[model samples]
Target: MRVYLPATFNSLTELNESGVIHARSGWAFAVTDALREFYTSGDEEELSDVAFDQAALASLRLLAVGDVEKFPHRRVVVSADVDDAHVTPVPDNGESVVRLEPAAVELDDVAAIHVDVPDAEEATAKAVTAIDAADLGDEDAELTVGDAQDNWLAFYDPSELPVLIELL
Candidate 1:
């Protein structure tokens, strides 16, 4: 899963370097402040803009499933304002807005899937079912992980991207 941050937050990259990001109020405020500075800056240095964009991308790369509670929408939306001479801008909706929803893989709906966490010393990696994670469906299904193996975690899913079921 990938997230796109606006090319305007400088301190985001620093947050990425600091592992084990906590879901604290102070951290959220820091992010908001960083973004505000980028959008409202009136300086000549373009490096600030570049740094902002880079930081956004890096934050997405380092995001964990546990961070979902902070935001209402887990999906990432990318917006760009196009002002090229070749193309004419629309009256109301000139900018391009793309919504990239989080790939939702149902634990019970999948045929076969695999999960692997080498760092996890325990036998099974603790995770939550898709339904439980986001209240997806009405079906009361319970799936199991780490049956009897080492360095091997498998489930029944049909998607290319690695799935991250909500950790229980």
Candidate 2:
């Protein structure tokens, strides 16, 4: 099974140093049965993209939590293929929600990572502050968050992990 997990540069550094990283929230996204049923029409790739988007949004929510000022304000999504047995669905917890347990995501499982480009830092910072409001249905706040979400990303192969840990 393929999973898109939310991450940050700090976490990437941890993975580099330890050869493994765990999602702090235990939540990851994937194209599950619920996701397929919810989408009226789309190919497998399109469905996967939706799961990826959810993971990106989840990354934003993490940035908005406590100690917000301390975290680097950028979004990251780690794409990996893990054994199907490792993933468990979160019932009625939205289409893509899943738990990855025993929670250790080893470096070997990583396929690639997608991260916000350097130019999007300002917008991402702004979005971090507004995510809570956006969640509460504030239109203006939603737009701020949307701008960050729409920012282009840079893709990196897992082999570049060392360089990415430093550059990000």
Candidate 3:
């Protein structure tokens, strides 16, 4: 199964150095039965995009919990192909979140990483700080957060992890 794991630049840097990501029942996004039912009109590609979007939102939550200054303001998510047996579906009221048992992934398991570009830094920084307020329906915070999303993340092959970490 392909799972999208939310991450930060700090985590990515660690993965680049150690060639591994150690997670504990990690919260991730995947195409689940519920997701399929919710987006009944969506084709496979569309459903996958929805799953990826959920991962991006989850990354924002991860950013909100961490020291914002310790890493770039951008959201990062790693996509990997793991055995279906390792991924367990998580029940959520809204989005499709999953749990990866023994959530440790070697670099070899990673397929790609999606991250915001340098130009997104300023808006992303604002979004990182405004996440809570935005969730509470603060209009200003919502705008800031929305702007950050406008700076769409770019995908990079797993082989580019080293260079990406250096840039971060």
Candidate 4:
């Protein structure tokens, strides 16, 4: 099973030092029955985008839980393939959230990392702080967060991990 794990540059650094993304039960987004039903007409690409977007949202929540100064204000997501036996679906609002067991993902398991570009820094920072408000139907906050999401993030192949770490 392939899952998108939302993270931050700080978290990536931790992964670099420890050589693992550790968790007792890590949360990720995947294409599950609910996601398929929600995007009834979505093709493979569209469904994949949906999963990525969900991971991006999860990144914002992760950012909110920490001191903003700890990392660059950019959204980061690591895509990895895990064994199906290690993943279980969580019930969410018409979406798929997966809980991963044996959650210590080695760097070797990551296929790629997607990171917001420098251009997205400002808006992404705002979105990081506005997530809760946006969730509560705050139109202005929603716009701020939406603006951030509109920016495209760059993708790095797993082989470029060392260079990516230096850049971060």
TM-scores for every predicted model: 0.19, 0.94, 0.90, 0.91
lDDT of 4 by residue, 3-99 (tens): 8888888767767888787532478877777788877697877887888888887787778777345565788888888888987778664376888
Local accuracy by lDDT, each model: 0.25, 0.86, 0.81, 0.80
Candidate 2: segments with Cα more than 4 A from true spot: 66-71
TM-score of 3: 0.90
In model 2, residue pairs whose N, Cα or C atoms come closer than 3 Å (at least 3 residues apart or on different chains), thus clashing, are none
**Model 3 spans with C-alpha error above 4 angstroms:** 68-70
* Residues 1-168 of candidate 2: C-alpha lDDT, one tens digit per residue: 999998877777778899997976788999999999999899999999899998898888777764333346878889989999999988588899999986889999999888888799899999989999998999999999999988866899999999876664
> What is the Å distance of residue 136 in model 4 from its true position?
1.1
Q: What is the lDDT of residue 133 in candidate 2?
A: 93
Clash counts for the predictions, in order: 9, 0, 0, 0
* Candidate 3 residue pairs in backbone clash: none
Worst 10 contiguous positions by lDDT, candidate 4: 64-73
Deviation in angstroms for 14 in model 3?
A: 1.4
TM-score of model number 4? 0.91
- Tens-place lDDT per residue, model 3, 33-117, is 8888887698877888888877786677778887345565888888889898988787664557888887888899999999988
